[model samples]
Target chain A: MSANKSILVCRCAERGLVDTDGIAGGESVLVIPDLCRAVADGDPMLGGAFSEVHACHPRAVQSLFRFAGHPLPDTTQVIDCRCDGAGHAALGTMEDKPPAWYPVIDYDRCSSCGQCLEFCLFGVYEKAPDGRIRVVNPDQCKNNCPACARICPEAAIIFPKSVEVPINGAEIDDEAAVRANIRVNVDEILGDDVYAALRARKQKRKALLNRKKIERALEERRKCSGGDQ
Target chain B: MKMEKTGVHGIPSTLQERDSLRLRVETYADQQGLVPPLSMEELRDHALELAPSSVSVDYVMVLLNNAVWRETVASIPYERRLLLLPQCLRDFKNCPAEMDEFGLLCEECGRCNIGELQSLAEDLGYVVLVAEGSTVVTRLLDGGKVDAVIGVSCLNALEKSFPHMADGAIPGLAIPLNAGGCIDTTTDVEHVRNAIRLRSDASWVNQVDTARIREMVEGWFSAIEIDSMDTRTEQIAYEWVCGEGKRWRPYLLACTYDALSGADGIFPEKVRRLALAVECFHKASLIHDDIEDDDEVRYNAPTLHCQYGIPVALNAGDFLVGEGYRLIASVPSRTADLMRIAVENHRMLCVGQGEELRGLVDTPPFTAAQLIEIFRRKTAPAFGAALRLGALAAGGDDRLDAALRRFSESLGIAYQIHDDLEEYRSGEEHDLRASILLALANDQRPLEWYAPDSPNLDHVFREMMVEEKAAQLLEHYKNEAIRALNPLASAPLKSLLRRTTSKMLTPAGGRA
Candidate 1:
């Protein structure tokens, strides 16, 4: 059976209904496994009662999080339905956090293979209609995964594995914390300047540092040779 | 009369020994105040500076001494085995003197001791003499008197012998305790036994196998009748593609498939061809990748682009890719259909490449959905295609194909996610792509819309370490892969498939 059909059947079975193909208590009914079990036990009334429950919530289905038994953490606002009799989780609300995603890229080594765009199942990539294979739209991503990075032969893709917001009393930019430090620095330093003078300055600084390093290495070599004599 | 040492290339085992002898000859070149006979500029320069002051009597003696020790230590059977004069042996070498007698005394008591050793040496056509230091040993070995050696030494002999003996193949056993640390008294009966064992145990043959995939290709070339008129062209074409490679990807394919099929079980030739075809595809990509990446070396050898020049290398890569298509197409009809899926994977690969390039140019917040979609298309398809090919090659049922496809895709995604995490974890300096993760996690909108984080916030950093976000995603995908594998009838294939999938979701323990 198709995955959707399986879900439908599972729902029918869980309601303990006699899945008869007809209107039952003002609801459409169909044959289901639990209904058969109830009928076999000669509990026609129980089966009928099952059909009634199905009628009341015909579209009721468990969320992916609920199905996986990893419902989102509770906060002050949203009610937590999976709590016990104890006062601990007895009253809880679903936490409000921004939708999270990780992107995997290796800027130093990326040789720009457009495999991620072609492979993506969602409309997650907007390859330039001009034939550039770049992802113009990542808002349509699924499951917050960064799969583009792994298949990159030169490892030019980056993705986040985890994102945690420090729950301490101090305020923190949880979003900035999730981004890479270098990227954060670059954004801060370069700040919307696509062609910043900072680029030349940084290159100059690197060149100066490299010269100093070379001079130091040469001096070291001279010392070793002199010491040998 | 003196015999001059002649170094020849043809008969000697290694170039090193001949060079050493040549160095000894040139060590005293400075005394002549003339340019050294050596033609090579570097060697000539070295000889001028390093040559000794003179090639006098003492120097010649030292040279002979060095030769003897080298012979004993190196154990190469040479012609000039003995440098000692007959007079040196004639005087006090073989005969033993009594304590009271001034003249030599030889009482043959048949005790089978050093006296016997000396007499037996003459009978056996070997040399028996009391020598002082390595000078004598070197002279003997260099003189070609012995192909192997047995040295019995006191502390002095042991120390003297150890410098060369430590690295030599021949065995030399030590017998301790002798007055004045002489070699004669320390020589023991057991030393003979050790020498016999050493000779029997050691093999002097060179053990090096130069066989490689390139060699196999060469052999095939030789077997095939390439028209002599086209021979040069064929050689060029063949060398262009094969180049110098260990063919590591092909090796991995062969090994992994063998492992998947339960070790050493042969698959049909068609399947084998498919496996090889995949490897060829991987290599062809690498060849092209090297050019695009501007890399100089691959596997410690010059990259194809570097060696053959970029344009030719590019053509060679294209040619190999063309060959890959031919190879895959040669497989059975159904397998060919599955292999065609590889074309889709190739498309995904290209898309991924473009995404990466674009990401560097533009900085914006990406949603989780967008990133996952990229992963599915880019990373998952290639890996998924590989697994599907393997399944199809095995003639797996529909259930098996569906199961493997789902398992491979999920596993591929998890593997990609783990890889992304690793890139950043390696440190910011190591990977430039860490920006992607940062953008995804922080930028929830277009670049202009997002507000920068204030410096005072440490709590924000803590939120970035939430392992559950990735762990949950990983577990969900891994569960799907496992669930897919459960229905397979072949326990072994199921186990193999499951194992391959599990490897993707494994916890990070080791660093690359």
Candidate 2:
């Protein structure tokens, strides 16, 4: 848990994965946004969703590098420009493959509800305090850009087709430009509606709050049930 | 009886018999497991004590004449009707007068109200439509999908809908707009909550199917908890007042939604679950009532305290309250909010208990008006909430919620008065004998009754008969009950309810 220890280690704990390689004495360890991909690409015990993410993790994480997976995740899937401030960023061309890193965003349409945050396991966007979303570390994104735009209540958030916006008045790589336009995380951009729904649903379930505690006991009972076998 | 180890497939069949036998044996606990049925006089005496007035007696008889209400309910296939009350109109907050204005007529503001109603429609759960006007109603019903309706409206919409509501042979309950025409108005919040509760019925057929209840009770005998002291307490509680009670509160809700949607047949799971919950509440209240009254017998069996100790019995009631609510809250999250209201209503029951207790000696000279207020606070909320929650569970229109509130309030007062008259006549005390009605009624009579109790007060019983003036005092209270019901708009259900109310309005000697 040292400052020098990568955040990936922290995220690994959050995602319920057991970390066997405990920062062994001064060994050089490459940082990657996702262990799911690192495990799936080279290691065993993961498949399907990983097969899809192996293609898109690298290009988005411009600052940090992930050695385990492919070069970059399809940035086209992480569409909202607000997440990346200066619109679509380019990461050169993967010729004969239609440059899988097309960036998309439609700002006027987004109601900014953070269902995408819950949907994304890869911590692609970080929610800011002022109710806007920012994508500070896109390198953590593991290809399956689910947090980008799957289901929005108001149909407010959407992916913009690969369009290029000028960043710093220079036409850079579309994935890079997309990366530079990092104003907020998708959740902060669409925070209110999800917050309201969560609040309402919570209030209604208040009487059963004790049941939640009971559920812990029930869980213990369930575990014991397996032990009985 | 030899315990049979039935196979899994055969478990359900035997479970039913087992539960039925369990109920029976529990009833006969005092007879050492040979409970003889109460004689006709015993039933009449109990019935009369419970329902002395003509109205109450008739209501009981109607319930007793199970053939009638059941046939009436059965013949009417479940139907649903939806009256999109003004609350559905998002802009309903705009105008002061245009809201669910205690008057009928709704100004549709075009919002999520219609969307919610549409989803209900698509579920094929019921026959539902946005009722913007009276003319549209006929066409809506002409499709013949709805047998009843849950309406949302001010008094104005109700005025327009009532004729169509009646024209369609539909049983409908209105969910009125909150106090102001607004959906989120503070005054309307409780009104909306109550109305939804009243309109929603446990739809016993839908969720907690008979198959499941049988399943849960299955293997229960062999289960670890069956013979425990707690189980015995529940058994004793269930034995008393376990016969022929219509889950009117829960069913009213299911019926309201079905009426609007033109759905047929009660969802077996819904009503079964609702019945379980409602009956638990009813049982819990009775346990406490018996404790307060100091009665030892009910339904011709020893009361909870008589069978189990008082402390255990009280805990048993609380356990049921908790269990009943959990059963309700355990439902899907979609209807979780409605279940929460069911739990909150238990607080209102406590309020009624407190009022009843405080009234025992607080000689504030009870008036008919005051008693009516007490009954409204104590009883109407439960009855009204029962019907509303069912409709809400089905996601009925917000408009009819208000109208249903008024309807339940009226019906509740009528029932309370009928109860007072019955108690006045039966003079049968099982427990909690320091009756509020008895005391209040006696208060209104001439002081001469307080004079040395003539022949009636002789013997050790003379002190008990000190309140002979109760019969005369009940007469005035009955009028107050009628007045309470006068405000709501008319419909067949209202008339039936009124008839049920009047049936219990007889003189102490079965003479109307």
lDDT of 2 at B173: 45
Global lDDT for candidate 1?
0.41
Q: Can you write out model 1's per-residue Cα lDDT over B1-512, one digit (the tens) per residue? A: 11122321121223464346435643443343222111122223443454444422322222232332231323322121111111111112344332110111223334425445444433433333333233333323321123344444333333344333322212222332222211123223443333323322222221111134234333332443434435553344445444555543343333334434543444456655665566556666777778877899887888878977888787767766776677788876685566666786777777865676565456554456656666666667656655666666655556766776676677766777666555545542233332334444453333333333434222443466423455567667665656555555543344345444544454454311
Show model 1 residue runs off by greater than 4 Å.
A1-229, B1-264, B295-302, B332-335, B428-436, B443-463, B466-468, B504-512
* Runs in model 2 lying further than 4 Å from the true structure: A1-229, B1-261, B333-336, B425-512
If scored against the real structure, what TM-score would every candidate get? Answer: 0.34, 0.33
Assess candidate 1 and give its TM-score to the true structure. 0.34
Error of model 2, residue B168, in angstroms: 16
lDDT of 2 by residue, B356-400 (tens): 677655654345456666666677766666656655655654544
Cα lDDT, model 1, residue B338: 60
